[model samples]
Target: MSTMLQWPASRPARPGDPLVDSFGRVHSDLRVSLTDRCSLRCTYCMPEQGNLWLERSTLLDAAEIEAIARVAALDGVDTFRLTGGEPLLRRDLAEIVRRLAALTVGGRPVEVSMTTNGIGLAGRIDELAAAGLSRVNISLDTVRADRFAELTKRDRLADVLDGIRAAAASGLRPLKLNTVAMRGVNDDELHDLVDLAVEHGAELRFIEQMPLDAGHTWDRSTMLTRDEILETLSARWRLTEVDGRGDSPAERFHLDGGPHTVGVIAAVTAPFCGACNRLRLTADGQVRNCLFARDELDLRRVLRSELSGTERDAALDSVLRASVLGKQAGHGIDDPEFLQPGRGMNAIGG
Candidate 1:
């Protein structure tokens, strides 16, 4: 298969585009966190005990978010992806999608995507699709209901599975499943998930466990590195690497004559920052350069200020400048001295 080069060039990037990074990488992709609330409390991604969330009045409104999206499109950003603890948790989310879909980059088009836990997706998939949802990424770490309950501390495995089925039925092709590979956690179901992908024609991606929470329970011993995972799964079927999609960190591969493919995201074992061409916009309107970094600039502050035109442009300029310098050579999460941020992954819109 050829590489997916659907990105349009007519999305003209200007000198003062608010989100452009220093490496000449136009911050074309905006990952927006709709809310910090989620139903399931995953051990690695979110706190088992839960924590306080940002005040509702302080969070950006749908109109404010749409304004940011329009500004991003004007700059060169042609992709607007919605993420959250679970995007479905937001009320009137379809309306949000509808508003973002109205924005365009230059004469070109912008891609709209979303990521969800898939529990609440069944009822909302059609509405979201009708509202201009281009694609969706669903997280399913374990296939077994028992293990799923143990991992997520919820009995929504059935709903998640039904959601996947409904999404597939809705003709949402190329539905991607994100699984975090933990040694004693869902590692046993690795091949089972591959088989699930094969059965559904969906792509299953194994993401290495990342360190972000204040929970010190995460250790290297629990990590099933990407290499070990591939070696283990190779015994079940002959695998061939698929050549396409350079921006994706996943190493794509397929089983011999299988209907589906598998991907490995080696963020911890091997970082892909050099090829990183993405920027993240938190729910509070902060621009995060790197996921593990504790630094960020609150764009909400300027968006709420009395500034207009060039003043707002200058504020965004300072943010873009700071992001360039703050872009670390690589994250130090693996190092012992690397202090993990107190924030949960859900808060940052994974």
Candidate 2:
């Protein structure tokens, strides 16, 4: 187990960097990676030879994460989600959630959420919910046991199902399931997911396979378009679009039967760059302005060393300043000639 470290006292915070995109969207959400480490080895998200793990000493502790969350809250970031290769791999994860849940800015509590691979969630879900987690998004690409093993190189389907059940039982209301639509792979499971959502009253979201991972060969034909998924799902159940929501990438729709919804996230084929409101903080104390960004602000030095409250606030200002300016109009991956940098999605904290 990793030893707990003391965090410096909170500093008087300042406004966060305002991200006004060309599409009239302001960035107001942040995804903080507690660890780039994960147990699953999904073929589309990782390379056969994975990335070197980040140094433990350089990682931002739970206190620092909450402190940063408070700073971002001042900047209009009210929603924060903890993500990782699989966030449950972090031993102090529940404690981290507790710290983040205790944070508030401008007299308002920030919404806390997490995305996990569901491997260890069965045992941890209740504790996490008790610690102030409002929602959870579990990654479940395939349902078939053998197919899941072949895709992730792991055999934990029963555990995954148990984790989902635990999340629901723990009152992680409206729990979401994320599945990446890979060509010829798991596309047939579209109806299966809809059935799960309909039966469990959970929201299942289908994501487009983007080209930002280490396994870089992307076949357009194999790519499942958002329209295709909707068309397939609508056949069985009628879907009505929901209204009055922030700039979420997913298009939410309600099932005809009752109070169930399924969302389609089409980041690649239908770019929502204009409405993108998310900023990323990697496990190694760096801020990523965009998913396809090649540069990151190194904040580990300040977090580790002795810096006055004013100095820390200055560092946060600098990081956010650099981040907003670096936001891209859109990921240039559509240009078939582009090459991606950085590690796979797992290493990059998807």
Model 2, 90-178: lDDT tens digits are 88899998887887756777789999988889888889888999899989898899999888888888898888888877778768899
Go through the candidates in order and give each one's C-alpha lDDT.
Answer: 0.78, 0.78
Candidate with top lDDT is 1
Candidate 1, superposed: residue stretches over 4 Å from native: 1-20, 24-26, 214-216, 257-259, 309-314
The worst-scoring run of ten residues by lDDT in candidate 2 lies at 1-10
Model 1 agreement with the true structure over 280-320: per-residue lDDT tens digits: 78888887877777788888988899988867766665665
Per-model RMSD to reference: 4.1, 6.6
C-alpha TM-scores of all predictions: 0.90, 0.90
Candidate 2 has a TM-score of 0.90
Runs off by more than 4 Å, candidate 2: 1-24, 48-51
